[model samples]
Target chain A: MASVVPRKSHNLRYKTLMAWLFTLPGLVVQLVFGWLPVLFAFVVAFQRYYFIKDPEYVGVNNFKEVVADPLVITAFQNTLWFAFLSVGLTFLMPIFVSILLMEMSRRTIRVMMILWFIPVASTAGIAIWKYMYHPNLGLLNGILRGLHLPEQKWLDDPVLAMFSLILPGIILFGPGLIYIAALQNVPEELYEAAELEGASFWRKIWNITLPRLRPIIAMMLLFSVIGSMQVFELPFIMTGGGPGYATTTVVMYIYSLAFGAYNLGKATALAIVLFCAIMIMVGFQRRYFPENIDESSENARS
Target chain B: MPLIPQVGRRRPKTRLMLLAIAIFLWIGVLLHLFPVAWMISASFKPTLEIFNAPFRLIPKEPSAASYKLLASTVNANGQSLNVDVFRYPLHIYLQNSIKISFLTLLCQLPITAMAAYAVSKLHSRRAAKWLFYFFMGTLMIPGQIAIVPRFLLLSHFPWPTRTVPGIPFTDLFFPSWSFIGTYWGIVLPAAFSAFNFLLFKGFFDTLPTELIEAARIDGASELTTLRAIMLPLARPVIAVTGYFTFTGAWNDFLGPWIILMSEQQKWPLSVALYKLQWALTSWQPSQGAMDPALQTLISSGVGYNALMALAVVESIPIFIAFLIFREQLMKGIQIAGLKG
Candidate 1:
């Protein structure tokens, strides 16, 4: 036993050295690109970065400028509005679609996902929608005309532009692959027992399905909230923050502030503000939801 | 097989509800597929007929003219007349897209996998927990926060400052390498995804430690154990992560847009598609004269058709990838380990 102690310690020491060696490459990369830049965000937010000049400390001036700009207010309002609309309009559509898809056989679910998940490049999708939203020649107006309904300025109007950005999401709604996975992970016995208790279809779904899906739904909600708050590409590509500040999200504002205006400091400051906003939402989600639900639920699976 | 068991189908009311559900799903599917269908239709149609009265799902002309415009190898003979040269001649950008996506996978998979494996197996438990956090801490932060800093970092490598600081007590400066305007700019930052690290780690943790113990007893090094035994068993995780990495890299716009924007030759399909769409939409026929680039597209017998054709071209690889990885992903996030 005494001899075994030293040998075991020696083996552990050797393994630890090998482990560090294996981790070296990833450490260097994660440090350089991952860790440093995250810390650097705060540093840049407080400094003035010029194109060809050295960065100078300008304590809180960038944040002050962000607060002073009226357009920044508009961008934040639009971002919040976009987030609100995304949650109300698009968030539950996946769950709803999955529930609807759940009524079908497993084979149908597989086939539908195969077709549904074949997504276009996001830019391409945006471009397609942009064309379809064209007031004069777009298909949406044409469909409106064909139906004898009033043709509206789909994207040209400030009121409708945000809606138009969300229109594709509503139209392209389908079951999320993750939601389907979560649904499948539910044990067959739960439903079998529910059915034996004379539970109706809707009863089974409400009692068995949704509760089982709660963790995934909770996590997805947090992700969706974070994602919609930082909505950049959709508005950037579709409207170009167009028809006034209607679709200019906060992240889009940061983009223009950084690249278009070449004011990196202010952009980083706005980005940090956006980060705080997302973190607050995430914090709320963590507080409300059991984040380690899957771990608990794993014992229930086959 | 589903929430509604097969035996329930015999009940009259249940059959009706199921029928209604099926109809609802089918309608959703059609609405989802309409844009893709229209994209294909417009790509094959003549420009006038695209917006013509009585909208058609199938093109009347059904010509390959727009595809020809995209596939054209012809240059602005000798003088390089067209200024918006990146607008057409699609193969170069297609190749660039493939290069960026593949190169990103090449760098990302091994690096991220090795780190995840080390955390899962080789490291002491206490150290592994901290190391896991070191790699994964980035996942919680909104990625937009670091965009400005990342750009600055890349523009002057190894320095977050655009201007490098001098070495203390010496006239010499720290060595640096700029990745801006090069493929490395995109590849280097994307090489270690904390998300993939999470996936790989979860997978490794699931495997019995006894396998590693056996390998070690046989005098295998940690690297060899990973390569010889662990990796072969990790095929499902690799498939899921690799497919994700490939698709993420392919669909990416902002990274390439920021890094390789100025270098036209380095533009991937995402950037090129954005440029093409911007050029296509910037002009209106009702407004008389047009940009020379628009005129070149017009002379070639298409307008927005080129953009549609390009969209189809861009989506092909993703669709092919979906086909190849269809089973792995559709096995659901259960197998993908995305659930946790």
Candidate 2:
């Protein structure tokens, strides 16, 4: 027993060492790329940094510059409008699409999902949309002309530019992969019971499907808000924030400040501000839609 | 028998509802496919035909002129063709994209799998808890905050500046290497994904500890057990993680854009596409006409067709990837969502 005890302790030490060995490479990567850069965001935000010279600590001057910049206000407004419109327009489409998809036969569902899941690279998708929104040579205008309707500059006009950016999303709406997955978790018996109670399809959906999907919906909402707030590629490619700063998102402004204007310190400071805004938005969402669906159900079951 | 009338009456109504749904879904499928169809068709059309035949679903006269131009370095008239639209030949950008994405996957898979294995299987409960937090803490912070710092880090690799503070003879630091204009700058930072780490750990947690214990009792090392047992059972998670990582790396725009901007030869398809589109859009007679030769090419519809062709080229690899991993991907999304 004593001999076994010593060997067991030795094995424990060996396991610990092996564990550390396995974790080392990933730790180094996450630290150097992930954590260190995040820490540097704070440091750089407070300093006047440029590639040509050493960093100089300036007391909130970068933040002051960010505040004074008029373009910053425009960027914030555009971003907020984008977030509100994108979420408002596209959020419920997925939930309803998922519900509608559930009504299809199993084989049909598989076929449709494959058709839906055909991967479109982000840049390629944006490029495709760019062609579609081109005023004179675009398919949309051609369709409009064919219908004997007047053509409008989709991306060239300020009022329609942001809408044009989001129109592709609304037009091409399909079931979100995550929402479909969540919808499948709903027990079949609940629907059957609702049907036996003479509930209509909409009634069953409203009662059984929606409540069950609340947690996932809340999660997707948070993701949508975050994603929409940081939208860079769509506007960056499609509009170049065009016609007149119509689609200049906050992230795009940061990109220009950092890379275009060569002001890294102010960019990082704006990034910090964007981070705080996102956190506050998340906090507000949590207060309104707490993720207690599973816990409350489990408590009821107990 | 009382239920018979109720069932009979509901049958036609149910059929009507289903038929309505079918029609709605078909419309959705058409709307979803319209733009993609246009893109593929436009890629094959000549530049003049692209603008002229906007309503045409299929190109009336399909031409590979855009592709040929993309492949050619000189025109038949013995004049050097300007490749500045894409900044390089099509294949060079394709090669860069493939190299960057593949290298990132090569590094990412093993590192994430091993770390997940350690946390899920090797470490004690308290130790695993702390380690998990250490790894995932960054997930809470918005990635945008780190962009500038990360760019700075890459510009001056191994150190953020030319000299180190408090170190004498800093000028002799030969080990420092700048990754700004290289694929390594794009590849290295993406080698560890916190999201995939969670997926792997969730999968590893489901694995029975007895198999590992039995292997250990049979005198197999931990590494052997991981390689032989865990890896074999983990094919699903591996496929999921691998697909996500591959697609993420492949579709990455901003990373390659900012890092490889100066080095045109290193620009991936995404960045090249952006530059091409920018050049195509920015060139107007009123906008101080950039390079008369390039202006002539743009006016000839070469720019439009080439851009569409490039978009097609960019999408094919990922489309093939999806077709290959369709089942695993669907299952993975479900598992990721549930576990997350």
Candidate 3:
């Protein structure tokens, strides 16, 4: 032991050098793509930046413009409304379905998961939905006609447009693969124990199952909230920010500002505002939910 | 054990509950599957028959017309319109998607795994903590904030500003390469993903340190230890991360759209699909709003049916990938600490 002590210190010095060597390529990538791009965002946010012109520092004028724009307000309102709708319509539906799916036989669960897991590329899927929402040639309208129900212009009408956007997710109420994986980790003994005392199904779920699943549920909620705030592609593709401005989300407005009008400074400012808003939401969530990543890994190990 | 006890499953009340659950799940599966079913069937149906009343799942008179159209360079009139955009045919876009996805995986996986391994095992504790955060800090930040800046950087890499930096006393400016129209623009930025970094680190952390130390003591070089010992053990993590990297690269729309928008021949299947959909919507089949150039194409009877066929073509690789990585993906996420 005495003889090995000096060698151990020397070994650590070697390890440190080797570690940096191992890290060199990833370091360059993160610097180029991850860190440097983010650093430029702040620089652009503060300056009257366009690609072709010299950046002139404008001292918060970009932020001032972002705040004063009525469309910015409208985009925020739409984003908040979409967030609320996503919570009500789609959020916990996966957890609830996965719970019930756990009560099914393994064979049925396997078949259901495989079928549900089949991929339709999101752009393709959105286009498929676009075809379905077509006023004259769509299968959705065809179904409405078959049932003798009045056909509504699904995507064209502003009133029902956002609803139409989320309608597929509501119908495609298949259990999430993540939820099923978490549900499988739930201890059956807890349910069995609940049964011995004459607990109902819902009661067993409340008393035993939920607490076991709380960590994962909290994390999924955090992700969905962050994800929903930056909802761009669905609305962008489905309606191109709509017949009017009904579907122009925050990120959609940012896209228009950057790519559409070429006011990249203002666009970056608006994006910074969005970034702060999401960070605040995440702060509150972490405070309340207190997700422990280490604890979940420990549970998995045991 | 199943959450619902097998013993109680025989009881009448339990049986009814089971019945309800079965019906709910089956309906969910079928409802979700209908759009996919329609995508495939619509691809085969004749264009006029696609809009026919009482829409059927299987085309009554199925035809491979769209598939043939997808294969050919010329329109149904056999007039080659190679000068027009969207006239490059499907194979070029498919090839671009495969190329971009392959190159991204080739660059990203090993580069990220090496960083993750260093942070997880090799570095000193204090250094590990800081390096981990330096790499993982982007996890909380949404990537969209940098879209404009990233686009600018790609147009003239390593210089997001209007003018490239010059030496203080010299007239010469730094050399800059434009990545905007190349596959490198997409492939390079994707070489580091903070999300995948989290996944790799989580996986590497769970691996025993003693095994690594033993390998080192046995005179194996750090690279050899990683290549032979750690890599074989890391197959599950590699497969899971590789699957995600491939899918993300395949399905990515905005990146390719921004980078390759001007270079029409470089567009991936995602960008092509979006263009097709946008085109179809703008020129509603044989309508007055249609451009005459597009009107000819629409008149050739390759409208929504051809779009559906393209969509089917785009989704085939992703479905194939899911089949290959189905088990690892589901099992690996639990190790990702999503499990409770």
Candidate 4:
């Protein structure tokens, strides 16, 4: 037994060494680019960073400023509003559409899902939608004219710009594919048994599918919050955070602070705040709706 | 009664109803595709026809002139709306984009695959789990948080293959291969995709253990076992990853915008398009009398056409790649389930 123990210990040591070696590159990268920057940003949030010079420490002053500043306060309010509304819309639209898509055969369902999934990948779809929302030459304006309805400036109107952003926000909900896959996995026998017991279609869906999908839906809701919160490119191209800051996301604001104003300190401060908000949101999600969803486990095989 | 009727009266009625739903779905799909159709139409029409009220679905006349002009036009005003001589040629930016995307694919795939294999094939579960947790935790850190630091890190670079006298090659090799305003900028930032690593690792994890055992028993090294046994099995995942990396690097505007700031000579197509945003408004009144605003409007159409044309051109390769890899892409996405 002692002899066996030594051999086992030796092998375990060797394997551990190899494992560390294998993991070193990713760990180093995560530390340098992914982890350290976050820590640095956090530190800088309390300090001040000036371009072409060293940072000077200032204890909690930046946070005080961030909280007290009217712009920051407004940004926080606007961000929360956008997040809640977009997250609600993105989450619900997919489940609703998936149910509608579910009323067809598996073949048709697959085609529709693919069509929906394509936009999640291709920026072309977003570009196309931007052109469609153009105030003068865009299709939406054309349609409004044809119908003799009011033509909106769309992205150019402060009141309407955020709403304009919402159109793509609604059209581009891709949670449907994941939802469909999850829906398909619910054992048919359960549904058949429900039907045999005289449960109506709506009742079967409510009881069987919704309960089964709680974990996935929870994760999707988290995804929607994180995604809409950090969104930059869409508004960057479509509105440039105008008509007058209505569409400026927190990320865009940070980018402008960092590059445009060259105020790395304020940018880092904003970034840390954004990061904390995300962490808090994620923490809330994990607390409220925890899952043993090894989401990546499904990534290995189709 | 038959448990599952195959073409009885009730089944047919149900099938007919489903078919009706399917046809209705086709209409919904068409409505979804409406914007894309409109974009194509706008790209083809002349300036006068584009803004004509009650915008015509069918153009009065369509022309390929916009596409042709964009493809060939070298010197055009960039994104600035109020500046002349602020323009750079699209071809240079396009070339830069293509160069960077290709290299990004080249560097990212092998590095990620090697790292993935290492993670999956490692003998210790504790180490593997830690690596995974570390990688996955990166997902929660909003990338915006890292942007400032990363930009700072990139600025202190001495790029494109330099040598230091004493040290091992990698450190010196690295700063020389620095990631600011160059192709390496795009490639390096993107190289460590934790999600891709997970995808690759997941695929490697599912491989038959016996094959690795046999290879090791035959005295093959760990790297050799990976090369011989694991890689061939992971071709589908790798191909999908490659396609994904290509598309992402091709379309990304943020990295370039942050890191590459020397305008005119140093920009990608996306940056060029962004710079060209107000290029139309900057047109000077041809040193003669005419409503310069009217002239500006006409020129603005040309610029607008150019921008849309760029969007179309950028999208074609991706759309074609989609058609080619439809099955694989679908299969890959279904598995990966989108981490970002």
Candidate 5:
């Protein structure tokens, strides 16, 4: 019996060691690339770092410089405008689209989904939009000219550029995969009950569908806000933050500061500020629009 | 009073609603696909025909001039346009993208799956809880915060600066090695994704422990069991995760844009396309006055046609990947959305 106990302990130790061996590589990668850089971002935010020289700890000077930079304000305003407009314009699209799609035949739905989500590379999508937005030679202008309408500078006009950046998303809207999945989870009994009550289609959607979709809507809202706030590639590719800083987002500003100007410290400082803002927004969202529906019902059922 | 509406009235209204919905959705789909179709059509048009009036959706005279330009460096005038800016051919950028994406997959899949398996099945309850948190805690923090620091770290590896702890002077500090201007810089940081780790762990949790225990009793090692038993059952998860990872890495722009900026030959198609667009568009007549070749190229509209061709090239692989993994990709999204 004593010998068997020792052997069991030996086996346990070997198992633990094996577990650690499996975990170590992933842990090392996460530490070096994920956690360490995040920690280093805090440190870099307080220091002045030019690649040519050793970093000098400036103690809030980078933050001060970030504040002083006139472009910072413009970037923030543009980002906020983008986030608000994107949410207002496109957030509920997938939910409504999914509801409409639920009425479609299965074959039709599949065909529509394939057409809608064609897997165009994001940069390629941006390039396509950039060409379409061209003033003189673009297809949009060509169509306008054919219609005998005056051609407008789509991207070069400061007022229209930000709107133009998001225009493609609005036009290409479809049911998000998430929303469809959520819609599928809406109990058939609920719809049957509504049908028995003679509730109209719109009423059923408003009363049952929207309420059930609230949790997903809230979650997607948060994602959209985060995504739009960090808008970089579209504006960067389409306008180069051009038409005189009209479309320069906070992220694009940080990118230019880091790479274009080699002002690493200031860029990190701005990034940290953006991080804090995003965290606060997330916190507010969690408090107000809690994702408590799934868990509570799941626990009740289980 | 009747509890339900009369079938006679309800039938037509429902059919009308269904018809309206179908019409609306079909229009939406057509509008959604318009840009992609336009891109393909524009790619086939000659530079002059692209700009010509009447605005045909189908090109009047479809030509391979733009594609031929991308395939080779020399234009019809026998002048080297160097559209990619670094003078490397289009295939070189494609090769770099493929190499980096494949390396990322090679490193990411096994490392992530192993860690997920350990957390999901091998670890003790308390230990698993802690390890899962450790891996997933990074998800709460936005990735942009790490961008600058990561760039700096890649530029001067092991140490972000020329300073080491316990060393008296800054001069004594030296980086172990730099990953800048290399594929490792892009591939290393992407080797373990917290989101994918969660997906893997969730999938693995659904696997029965008795199977693994049976393998153990049959004298199979943990690695052997994972390989010979768990992997066969994990084909769907593997396919979904692999597709996401490959497409993500393939389409990543900023990472390659920053890390491989100086090494233009190593730039991916995304960065190369960006540079090409910038160079072509930023070419002012005043700037090109000294170079007749530049003026001729600008006036010919070849740059615009070539840009469209590049866009087509960039989108083809992702389209093919989607087609191949269509079911798995949709299932993955459905699972992720429901779980979230």
Candidate 6:
């Protein structure tokens, strides 16, 4: 006696159709909000125009003007310098702090990690470092006075102003958390193996820990560079782009042009240029540092 | 399995030093909290007591006078219009912020999550891989370049509601460039973020493949499977993204500053706080009957207090949510970081 068997062939065609349908929303968003506008920004860079008026094709004048203007030149140079110094400081501080944090017992490390993360969660604009920089009544100045040293107008002098802007953010670094996370992810066997080989704490860090952390170090460097280049609110609030444009950043420049002066075309042009510059530099960095330098050759020298 | 365990006891001195370091970290935390505490303490003080001879860590006489000022009314059109003459009515702004944030989240999160899932989980292996690459590639494009065109598009939007041809209500709705100071202007641009989509995709990829296979064998439709199974499973990641989105909207100042006129009544608290100082210092508060020194100090202190209050109020929701979902939030963050 033969039984009537059920025929069931799962059709994946329905899944394919459903998948496309599901992706439609994101496609629309990226098309409208991302790609289209970015394309227009590139087009705007080749033209000289304002928001209300028609754009006139000026092929490279905007770039030439950007390069020729002394202020723009200074901004570019200052941006690079700021990026280098700030990224170095941020990248190095975290690695050192993370190593220190790793040396702690598990219970203590959790507490330290939690404390390190609180400031990162808080609003960047609300921190009152500018107020604390007040010459007469400020905390820093008060300390200087206590030591019988003359007070300085922290926000007034051009040479010291940019450093002042960076000073407040130094203590606000959240790299400790990232470094801790990276350190925790390292395999315990490697440490045990190193210990069996008579590796000291510092030697373990140099030989294994730092090498393992190289990728994260690279990531932190890239982010710090981008972040410092885009610094806006802190300096904007503190100095208002002054003691005479000493600390005016690329983003601040675009802001003043577009919103302050109503030159949307030029602003868009500048923005596109900055974006390209960042991409090229970052691409170069990634290409040059393809394999992270994680070898253990220099363990004894340091 | 235990991830780590003692291979023998550590030395006592190393243990003591670690304890000391932990204490130092707590002290560092106290330092970080100092400004925030000052901001809170300043908000409770009366206007006259702001620059009191010595700084008040704990307010000598705490009052809700500032918050009251933010909610009080001024006479207009022969009646009170609930205008805040000194401080902006932050409570109203807070409501608008909540409405926009929730609307944006409700509309965007499921849609983006679905898209991300489709790209990552619901396709032939090759198709999914290529789609993932394309989506990730978009992250290379910075947001600044898109500002001008986006603004132009928003400003020149055709009217949503229209009238019948040759009717009395011909002007009911015409092509209009009048969204500058409206809620839609803020919501439309901010609703779809790539970062959230990528985050969700990362979460979805880590999920076991067996669940999908089980549902498929059960003859559940793809959409049904997504709705009934995937969405519920993605809760922790969704929650983190939702909180971040809400806070981003609440704290966004640049968008409003660009689109809104100074006197627009519907601006968010961030914009209101910024404009508050600009309005006061426009003609220099020290120019008139007030003594220059006192006027400057008072104006600065007032501005500072308003900013502090706004920041604290805006941050409370995110902090509470984070505390509630602490464990899952950390896990979600780790997933996102690894993918990044």
TM-score of each: 0.94, 0.95, 0.95, 0.85, 0.93, 0.85
> What pairs collide in candidate 6?
none
Answer with 2 or 6, whichever has the higher TM-score. Answer: 2
Residue B295, candidate 6: how far off, in angstroms? 5.0
Residue A277's lDDT in candidate 2: 97
The alpha-carbon RMSD over the true interface for every model, in angstroms, is 1.8, 4.0, 1.7, 4.8, 3.9, 4.1
DockQ of 3: 0.65
Q: What digit string (tens of lDDT, one per residue) describes model 3 on residues B1-340?
A: 3567888789998899899989998999898888999999999998778766327888888988887787777875678643243578889989999999999999999999999999998988998999888898887788888888888888888898767789679998899989988999999999988888888888888889999989988999999999999999988788888998999999999889888988998999999888877877875444556587667767777778988999999999999999999888766766765412
For model 2, residues B1-340, the per-residue Cα lDDT tens digits are 0111234445887678777987898788878887788888888998777766666878899999888877655554655645464336789988988998899999999999999999999999999999899888887778898889888788776665424434566655445667888989988999888989999998898889999999999999999999999998888788889998999999999999888888888888898888878767765455674876675566545767788899999999888888888888877777776766
RMSD of 2: 3.1
Can you list the residue pairs that collide in candidate 3? none
lDDT of 4 by residue, A37-59 (tens): 66667666766776756678888
| Better candidate by TM-score, 1 or 5 | 1
- Superposed on the true chain A, the predicted chain A of model 1 yields a TM-score of 0.91
Every candidate's DockQ is: 0.65, 0.57, 0.65, 0.36, 0.55, 0.37
- Give the better candidate number (2 or 5) by lDDT: 2
DockQ of 1: 0.65
- Tell me candidate 1's interface RMSD: 1.8
Cα-based RMSD of candidate 6: 5.3
Estimate, for each residue in B1-340, the C-alpha lDDT of model 5 and write its tens digit. Answer: 1112345335776668677888999889998888888888888888778666425778888888888767776666676764455376678878887898899999999999999999999999999999989899988788888888887777667776534333466545443678889999999999999978987898888889999889988989999999999988877678878988988998899889888878987988889788877766765444545355455555545666778888888888888888988887666666666565
Q: Is the docking of candidate 5 incorrect, acceptable, medium or high quality?
A: medium
Stronger candidate by DockQ (2 vs 5): 2
Superior candidate under lDDT, 1 versus 5: 1
True contacts kept of 1: 0.73
For every model in order, the fraction of real contacts preserved is: 0.73, 0.68, 0.74, 0.36, 0.67, 0.31
Binned by DockQ into CAPRI classes (incorrect, acceptable, medium, high), candidate 1 is: medium
- Can you rank all candidates by lDDT, best first? 3, 2, 1, 5, 4, 6
Q: DockQ of candidate 6?
A: 0.37
